[model samples]
Target chain A: MEKEVILQYLPLYREALLLTLRIGWQGVLLALVFGVACTWIRQLKIPVLKSLVTVYIELFRNTPLLVQLFFLYFALPKAGIRMTPELCGSLGLGLLGGAYMAETFRSGLESIAPIQEESALSLGMTSMQALRYVILPQAATYSISGIVANVIFLLKETSVFSVISLMDLMFTAKDLIGMYAKTLECLTLLVVFYLIMLLPVSVFGSWLERRMRRAEFGA
Target chain B: MKKNQLIAAAAAAVLGISLLSTGTVFADEAFRTLDEIKESGTINIGVFSDKSPFGYVDENGEYQGYDVYLAERLGEDLGVEINYVSTEAASRIEYLQTGKVDIILANFTVTEERAEEVDFALPYMNVALGVVSPDDAVVESLDDIGEDDQVIVISGTTAETYLVKNYPDIKLQKYDAYAEAKTALENGNAAAWANDNTEVIAFAIENEGFTVGIPSLGSADTIAPAVTKGNETLLDWLNEEIVALGEEQFFHADYEATLLDTYGADYEDTLVVEGGAVGTVETEAE
Candidate 1:
């Protein structure tokens, strides 16, 4: 690999990395909101909304991100639902991430024993009170590892945002390769930048998982 | 801990040695010569499967276009079968450099930047940048483009380079595929789409409600075949073949066979380059 080319393109890769982080975290935030909402709906047995959540989760989870992105960027504009590339990218990532996040949270919520809710209810606490005070905290601990995995998964998915022309790290690498034909140098830089963006999240994820396990299990 | 350190050190040394050996393998001869290609009995030729008129796959799943026609002839004369490799604009150079394909006939416009990496053969066609936009808001010149409006371009094309280099302030929405760029223009996501004049002209003719407002944007350039750098046998043969075909006006026939239906008669003289020569016919006609 050519060290000079990698050094020269470092600033460009840095800019792309920042954009990726912005979009990735935004998507993860949206995913959290959507996942919690959907999980509550399913848990509380809300009428028509529960089935809709089920369908939404299945649909987004089943298809590839590339197809969803193409439909959003190209097909949606035909129906007068035009969006900027950045908006389209974050929304696509969010929608796809939401489904997985909901599934993860549901599994975590299911792991809670029914007796905990029963005990809180018999103690004169309302169902909402029981859920807020007795159930969600434990579920949040259980879901930590899954949430971290989903966040990293969504961040990696940002690589496909280049199809809609958002100038992410992959786009920058490809554009450099096209213009200069320095494949090895550009690809090496791509790997280094992605590791820089993802390694911290991955490390923190495992740390958080370990801490949550220890806290709940009484180390 | 001391034993662990020794194991880690040994692993690192093994990895370092392996990487050095692979580096030496890469430093050896990288490209295939003409005789080598003949011995294989098949030459891999890269062409765009989406960019119609120049290179594209037809409804029958057969490759048909101006470049494909020339590629077929090259394969026939070399007594080898042709292996058509579909290439994207950005991947064209990568394909050549990696020996993924022996030649790229992807309507590749020759430029100084690319010439440093790949050896270009004689010219087969002439091209210049053009802007195609909605008839209502025709982009007549670069100065008329609105500040908020974006112009679409395929990634790695000369139009993208020219606009980014000269008109840095202009917003560009770049796609990796011709079909995607066309779709973007149709969706009205951009004010205009800039590409080779030949492609934009064909787009205007084939599709309704669009016009080639800026018929020519930058300096005229030639489109040619490109091979891996230092592949002198193939390069020399291509030059000779082009000069020989000039005597028979081969490219004109190629135009008639593939491009004429899309480009029509008026573009015949201006577009086709017979026998590696540029501007000769126009000068003679004048």
Candidate 2:
């Protein structure tokens, strides 16, 4: 790996990094919204909508993000539901991540004791008030680890955006390798950039998990 | 205690032997000579399995096209069975450098930059960059490309290099595969597609509502077989084979057999190089 080549390609990597962060954050935001909404519907036990949410979670969880992106980008254009590559990429990530997040949130919600709801009702709190004030705060703490894992998974999934010509970091690395045959240099830069993007999230997640555990157990 | 030590020695010997055997297998793959290939009884020739009329797989899963026709003849003369290795546009050089394929015949256009990486054999066909676009909004020249319109190109191709260097103002949407680039064009994701003249002409002929608005965008270049950098024995043999094949007008016959249906007679004289003689055809084409 030559120093000159790494220095020269740094700008391209920088541009790709910005694009990746933009799409990744947007996707994670959508995923969080979908997760909370789906969990609320299932918790309320809505008649038809609960079954529909179950079907959606199963469908998205069973299929890969790559197939979903291909369907949205290539196949949907035929049906006149065209979306730009960036939109398709984030949408695919959001839909896939939502299924995993919903499951994570549901497990957290299920862990709450029945006495907590009963106590809230005896205290004259409505069911909605109990869900908002009593259960959700506890569930957020319980679900932190799983939510962090889903966020990291969705961010890494942005690598496949190159297939739609979105020019993410992976695409830039591949294009440089193809044009110049600088495999060692391009791949070294790729690993470094990905570490730069992912390590912070991992460290922060660990810190948050420890804090939540300490607060809950008081030991 | 003695028995345990003896068993340990035997296990270490087995592991050493296995490692040495694997090492030799890798050593043999670094580079192979003409004689080495003949001894193997199967020579791997890399060609494109997607780019139609030049190198592509047909309905029966058999390789067919202009490049494959020549590859078949080379295998026949060498008395070895041909092993067709499908290659993409970007992996051509890496395939030759790594000894994954003995010869590459995937519409490989010779350039000075590429020649430094791999040794190119004598010329068989002449080629230049060409641009194809939709008929309703034809792009007659580079100037016609608007600021917002992107030109589609395959990654690592000569067209990509030329456009990036010469027409810096033009935006390019690059794809890794020909099929994807074609799909992008069909979907109207770009204003025009720039590729080899032979390919663009073939596309314009095959697909309706498209025309080759700009023919011959860059300097004329030759298409030839490529081998590893220092494999003189194989390189010499390929050059001699091309020259000898020229004696019987082999490339013209190849054009008739594989390219005639797509190109017709008009492009026959302009494209095919006889007897590895690129100069005569180069001048006439110019």
Candidate 3:
């Protein structure tokens, strides 16, 4: 209710913001690894492995993040696979993001021509070298926007960590409401905090898109 | 490391992951006793991080509340350090059963079903369900509740359980945290919030344009400390601690220090349970 009280809680808010960012970035990196690896396997037409990748993506994307986080935080611990809240939060976000990111990577990878790979191979390059140098780089340029979008979604999805008691930024706001009973003020602060965090990444995403487009299309 | 050694390590890790499905780390863990905790010099106690006036984090970023105050005194009396583990309402018993916390002081209400799973100490506080709503559309009683009217209840609280069993027709909007439930009530998404009487009373007192219409909905119950089943030594120590604290009128002091800010002087005598008097005064079923 009071501005002074809000000001006093700055340290708590800062700590929470750090946690949210930590989970968000770790999750994004993990999603990138999963998305690119699955896309590569599917493109290579690995028989059983491709189907397994498809299964992983479909299963995670279809289920709710709340249930996934709950299973990791509550149920798995009961089964002796004890994990910290941070691990659960990041892994859940990563798994969900990886599913969506894999789809984006598929579309991007499929758009590049077989000629691009054949041409690189003719120039004394191995098939793996062709993918690393010619094909994957072009695919990345095509899919940077999609990757950025997935990261944005991942940032918001981390709020579900509060349900499993991860002490992220949203959980800190909930605690603020409990202490001060000022839902309006606390929520306003929360909105502003999120905007401050995500808006920059969104801006950087557009910047990267423009740079990549010019690099591809310009002389 | 060499390439062959690296491959061997990775294979080992993968095998370990596969083996976990058949193992249970907690199923064999022995229930912790007071002596073990005293010898270790630190006792893990689970307390809420969101519920107001009971166990909640303050602006100072430190956990300070009624239940937290009790846990601190308990640690001091037991000659050990208190490692406060934050727990949600739904996770309190799970925290005990999994050996995550040695004691749970998260305002656990003593119930017959819960007793089968965990041991309870003497009652420290009394509680009953209460409904709070906007002043203009005050929900005075459940009898007047419309079929379409939505009631907000915290997911794991006794209020949700009571309403579902007794008034199955009334629509309920369940939330996992007090903050979300209050937001639903204030945003007009729900007609009223049903929670513990003390929480409802504190909300109405602290926030404007809200009123506690149905202050006592169900038969009163007592909140007490809980531990894992078969941890009788710890439970007995806790029982003796409650008696000692009562002789010193420690609960009254706790009321003055933590609860008086929200509740004031009125309900002190009834709310503070002395010497863990186990049950409520019997009421004819209504």
Which candidate wins on TM-score?
Answer: 1
Give the alpha carbon lDDT tens digit for every residue of B1-286 in model 1: 3355446545755565566446435633567899999999999999999999889999999998999999999998899999999998999987887788999999999888888878898888988999999999999998888999999988888888899899999988888889988998999989999999999999999999999999997888889999988899999999899889999999999999998899888898889998998864231110
Considering the two chains of model 3, state its CAPRI-style docking category: incorrect
Per-residue lDDT tens digits for candidate 2, residues B1-286, read 3355446545755565555445434534556899999999999999999899999999999999999999999999999999999998888877887789999999998887788777888888989999999999989999989999999998878898899889999988888778778877878889999999899999999899999999988988889899877799998999899989999999999999999999889999889987778764342111
- Model 3 lDDT tens row, A133-160: 8887788888999999999999988777
* Best candidate (score: lDDT): 1
Supply the global lDDT for candidate 2.
Answer: 0.86
lDDT (10s digit) by residue, model 3, range B69-179: 899899889889899899866556557766889999998877765676678888888888899999999999887788888788775677877887799899776556776
Question: For model 1, how many clashes?
Answer: 0
| Interface DockQ per candidate | 0.39, 0.16, 0.04
- In model 3, the clashing pairs are none
TM-score (C-alpha) between model 2 and the true structure: 0.86
Model 2 per-residue lDDT at B56: 98
Stretches > 4 Å off in candidate 3: A1-219, B1-30, B278-286
Q: Show the lowest summed lDDT stretch of 10 residues, model 3 chain B.
A: B19-28
Q: Which segments of model 2 are wrong by more than 4 Å?
A: A111-126, A129-134, A215-219, B1-29, B280-286
Candidate 3 structure lDDT: 0.79
Number of the top DockQ candidate: 1
TM-score of chain A of each: 0.94, 0.94, 0.91
